[model samples]
Target: MNETLAHEDLPDGLGLRLKVDVTRPLTDLTAAVNALCDQVAERRATTVVVLELAATPVDFREWPGDVGIQAVNRWERAIRRLEKQAAVTVAVARGTCGGPALDLLLAADFRIGAPGLQLILPVNDGHFWPGMTLYRLVQHLGVARARRIVLWGADLTLDKAAELGLVDQVSEDLEEALHTAAVLTGRISDRETAVRRQLLLEAVSSEYEDALGVHLAACDRELRRLRRTRDASPQNLVGQAAS
Candidate 1:
């Protein structure tokens, strides 16, 4: 299994289209992650469309010595960076998504799964691999369902995943999903989007009082920008002339 990652600009500069083939070893996956990070850091796209292809299962146990652990760490960091840095990240799951592929889906802002798509966890010797993937599942699905997935070895079907908020959309057509993602990313500045995403991420761990100041600041910034736009409009100019 040779995992690969590539990206190209969407038509009319709408965003970037990223294709990820997950059937590869950790070394290749790490390289792919690095490439993705560089692409996002360039800030050439406002939204990222992640096409997750079928993934070949990865066994962490097979990674020899410290090399395996280091690769895993780097891979996780790269995925986190993509989620935080990209203005809007949307993932489309086709066929089976497991291991590293599932990790990327969990990090995405929006997830769309194709019909018959299955989400799998890594199991070795009849036991689930205890890793950060567990944290992701728990964060998205809460404890009970995450437990079912991690401990009971349950696979998430497309409909069930959508019902549980794991997948935002279930579409048979990949193009439709991409269109939906592009539409959803419309009319927002990348910087503002990043701020809003940060707020949401922090809200999960912070109390209302702790988050109030940041939220208020964001509101102030938005209001000022709106006022500036209103003042610059043709309608405002006409009203001033009449006065």
Candidate 2:
């Protein structure tokens, strides 16, 4: 909420990485979701949108039970958008994560956890909330593994989450970890990044037989792209002259 400390809507340069500081919503993020969309829609400049989660899982039990179904649906859609956003979405969790925080983290392309980080099931009156996060947990860990966390409310320590590949990196120094993440991703353009993400998602969700066609199409496109590059290269021109 500190405007002075937060980066502006857009990144200043190619070297800068923008962190999308999550506002711990009391009921929903419907109002702020547009900001998330805008961050990803930036076509001119490559950006890395980092969502920081520290005061998360702040007693979801205390949340009012009056959230409407429509609001929840909108929230779910927004989270999906975040997952497929062009900007490389990064989640940095410190302390406990559950509810919306957990949802965002799971949707991120990269996840980093600071020391003392933990994950908890978002339960309401003894049952887990049937949000996109639940579906994502199943997608990430599969049915057998997510069952324990959802049905039994099992909490995961940072080390356990990292072992499961839920948390990509664990660091005592979060800033350095963030910088490392930026380097690792190499900030591809937004549309291309989203296309790649969609391909990966389909690889997981699609049936084995159905996956082949999709992969073949991608392969064809890649081949064409490579051919274009090769034909335009200086070596190819020299070889053509020699021939």
At residue 48, what lDDT does model 2 achieve? 72
Provide TM-scores for the models.
0.85, 0.85
lDDT at residue 238 of model 2 (Cα atoms): 98
lDDT score, candidate 1: 0.72
lDDT string, candidate 2, 103-124, tens digits = 7789988999987888876777
RMSD of each: 3.2, 3.1
Worst 10 residues of 2 by lDDT: 10-19
Model 2 off-target regions past 4 Å? 1-28, 62-65, 187-190, 237-243
lDDT of 1 by residue, 111-168 (tens): 8888888877765556676667787788777788888777778878888889889899
